[model samples]
Target: MSQVRPGARRVLGATAVESPVIQPRLRTIPEATVARLAVYLRVLAGFADGGRTTVSSGELASAAGVNPAGLRKDLSHLGSCGVRGVGYDVRALRERIARVLGAEQSRACVLVGLGNLGTALADYAGFGSRGFRFTGLFDAAPDRVGQRIGGLPVQPMTELEATVTGTGVSIGVIATPAEVAQQICDRLTAAGVRSILNFAPMTLTAPAGVDVRQVDLSVELQVLAFLGQQRAVPAGEVPA
Candidate 1:
């Protein structure tokens, strides 16, 4: 079969064609490892665009900001054995990682909160352009509710439970204020949401089996400040 270049096809290692769903035989690979596979896939695609046909484990690690040994170990779980001296086939590895990450299949997402950030996220072209489709947007404010943002209807928060339950929304983007984030999270969890991409600046407690990933603007700014301060310090000024 002729494979379409730049399409959603996966190439595992040198010759294996794999699907995104984890098979019973490959259940040993951790979910964290699976997440990183997508990161690696994006890096490899960059290399492929640069005319590189092959990449070593060390090279892939450097590009993806991971250790070579760890990268190799993760790839090994996918049955990707790097050639002893030839390294890995870049195209093959890229496809395999995409397959494992389900890049070919789009996942639906719901966004809650119609604040500035939420509005921007609702309008974000990256999500839909990628494999994440946003089918619902919600907010608690009556004035904002029933409005349309980013081509998605901003429904009232009262409908969150039903919309999520009916849509089988596995992923949620929480853009609500810190005060209401946990409450929203609880509702989402109770409504069967399993994964959350949290932009609220508060710690949310969820029961087992729920995955919550936080994106804190202040935290990122602080890290950037730390890096800037480190650069300003003298190399040998440790006399404190």
Candidate 2:
């Protein structure tokens, strides 16, 4: 019998050397840290586009509109750090964030309503890159019942439960009008959707155990108006 090398294998049933096994490290980063990671990634993308190789924490924070200390803490959670004098590697950090966020994998999502914003979101390509797959489209409109948006066929509101059950869709995106926002949310909850990203301009009242994230355009505009008013006022002026 021939002796195999320490790191080599022999043919057939001959002796084979074992290779070093690498232990997988377990990491549990905070949810807040994970959220900031995306902002850092976008900042890194801008740097990459400008041919930048390194970015200081301060620079990244400024670019991403975050605090320097907060950005440093978030990056540190991933076991990544900038050298004493040098900054972080823009490309490497972006790839690391993408991996941690599971951006490469495809996640299925269901969209309710076929209004303008809903149609636009269905047509948006950014969701695909971020592991979001728009698999089902539902609407109350009779005409939109049989329509197709972004290659996904639209189904009537009545079929919402069946489609969600069949496809195992958990993430729901509600884009219905303000009047029917709560009603639609209840139906989505009934269909076993746990998480919802609502675009309707109203607060949704769902049962316990259901997560509803509201994205009200009108409320956003109000916030913008408040900020604009602050800017319009003098630096030392007080608002009534």
Specify the highest-lDDT model's number. 1
Q: For model 2, name the residue pairs that clash.
A: none
TM-score of 1: 0.73
lDDT of 2: 0.78
Error of 2 at 206 (Å): 2.4
The TM-score that candidate 2 achieves is 0.75
Task: Residues 1-240, candidate 1: write the lDDT tens digits.
Answer: 011111233332323344557543444566556667877877887899899988898898998888899888889887855688899988887777777666767887899998999999988886774578887899888999878887778898888888888887889999999999999999999999999888898888899988787777777667678778789894856578
- TM-score of every prediction relative to native: 0.73, 0.75
The regions of model 2 sitting more than 4 angstroms off are 1-33, 49-54, 81-84, 231-240
Model 1 misplacement above 4 A: 1-35, 48-53, 65-70, 81-87, 230-240
After TM-score superposition, what is the CA distance of residue 83 in candidate 1 from its true location, in Å?
4.4
**Per-residue lDDT of candidate 2, residues 1-240 (tens digit):** 001111123122213343336523334565456657877776788899999998899999998888999889888866755677898888888878887777756777899988899999999987886778988999988988888889989998888888888888869998888899888888878889899988886778888877666665666567678779888884857748
